[model samples]
Target: MASDQPRIDFSGGAVGYRFRRSGERGHPLVRAAGIKRDHMPSIVDATAGLGRDAFLLASAGAMVTLIERSTEVHALLKDALARAAMESPELAEVVGRMTLVHGDARYLLPELKPDVVIVDPMHPPRRNTALVKKEMRQLSSIVGADEDAAELMRIALATARERVVLKWPLRAAPLLEAPKPSHQYAGKTVRYEVFVTALKPHVK
Candidate 1:
């Protein structure tokens, strides 16, 4: 491992602190994924790198399956989740709601048949690198760029029973190759672009 490689430590340090502070409340993602008391969606996080988003969703009561294609990242996430789960009662409960799969989502989406799919392909490197976090930069080197992100979105749109939520850089242009999002939830840095599937009306 290199000095620049970001350690996947979910139970301690910054990640743990953030997850602890965020708690199990509904953030923008809860709304983006349409999580409600009557509607706890089964979500497949297709590009679950560090799985921060998946952890957040699981904490919010959704059953989340995190799919990480990179072998190294998958291993890191697996260890981190296990370590985090043993840290406390609350974390254990949240980790119980998450499932990690080591595979490419393109091949696994149809088989999983989730109600919602989250495609957060790493965004292209920003021109102004000053704003990019050191951890993010290190993670980028591990995963590289998501060149097939457009295709991933198309497949997710076709597979999800309800919707596909795309986490993207708010300032960047939307994926032209993918269909227009049915809705958008904008945060300070990133946004969740939702594409409602044609499968049927979302369950209330």
Candidate 2:
């Protein structure tokens, strides 16, 4: 089923299922990104794998920019977004909030200057363990282990106006090279680690 593998479909399937549960509040990514009824910070998903988190942020009312370096992944996101926009007015509204960019985020981050930057760069799959997730398999086949995660985090912190969020697996060690996150929002299997890089958070 590799060819028939689940792609990023906002209309239906796992990505769609999660999108349905996304609200303006309550979700950990929502909290970590400081998404509220009145304050939906502009966010940049530095590693826009499949565009799922970026879509969720848009659903919660934030203007999100997604940067994907991989051309194939970017194409998948673009096609899914186009198809989803035609599904309904509600879906269109959310899709409209997301802007997709294809390039290396390290260079693009400075120009975007978002209120928040979210980094979920790929990690080398755990040693000696199988990558059982289809998406991980696809990602590994495409991008391999992201050796520059620390560098990306450093750039994100420098570029973001308010803060940077790192999406990581629960129980994994934090990146030692980057400044420790100011705090973290943990879920059942993953966490959003927030690093407050801005001394004064941008407020409207």
Candidate 3:
């Protein structure tokens, strides 16, 4: 029998997840990269932590797919999305455009062909524990770090048809430097590295 805990959904406004003004500036790297709300490629948010970036991408018109391995986080995100769907018409549309999958990104990403695969793995929280936001702490606790992010990037590069976008802090080194990026967005502390790759050819 499953635990009798009340599950949280990230579909609607169930978790109070909102795309307020600050969210536009949520990740400096994304904004600095000139990633507009209207120009987005088919995206697979592999790390779908809290689904913020995924929601933003969908709102920006990208066909976004989110993958989460944690049942608790997935349930919370689903509930929040469901609640947001009922309350905000615009958010509802964005949520409608998103597809959530409960599984590991490595195994699942290879099966699909997306223009861009977006990865934002969980990193260390600020040392001032009190200063850390509630959601940030919650996310850290749930997702932890993808110590094998290098491998994830390798698989993402193999799967993506066009490019793989890696969102990381400016201080950290690029993921293995495997796929040399054609472009980069350097923000205050975070950066978005776009690793371009040719789409697989079809042999008709």
Q: What is the lDDT of candidate 3?
A: 0.71
TM-score, candidate 2, is 0.89
Q: After superposition, how far is residue 73 of candidate 3 from its true place, in Å?
A: 0.6
True-vs-predicted CA distance for residue 32, candidate 3, Å: 8.6
Ranking by TM-score: 1, 2, 3
Q: List model 2 lDDT by residue over 104-180, tens digit each.
A: 99999999899999999775454333423766777667766788888989999988988999998877788755577
Stretches of candidate 3 exceeding 4 Å from the true structure: 1-40, 125-133, 200-204
Q: How far is 73's C-alpha from truth in model 2 (Å)?
A: 0.7
1-204: candidate 1 lDDT, tens digit per residue:
657666676677655776778754657777999898788989999999878889889978889999998888898899889998888998899899999999999999989989999999988665544524666787788889889998888889879988999999888988855468888998777899989884545642
lDDT of 3 by residue, 127-167 (tens): 33342356566666667778878888899888887777888
Q: Which sections of candidate 1 miss by over 4 Å?
A: 13-15, 18-24, 127-132, 201-204
Model with the higher lDDT, candidate 1 or 3: 1
TM-score of each: 0.89, 0.89, 0.77
Sort every candidate by lDDT, greatest first.
1, 2, 3
Model 1 CA lDDT for position 11: 71
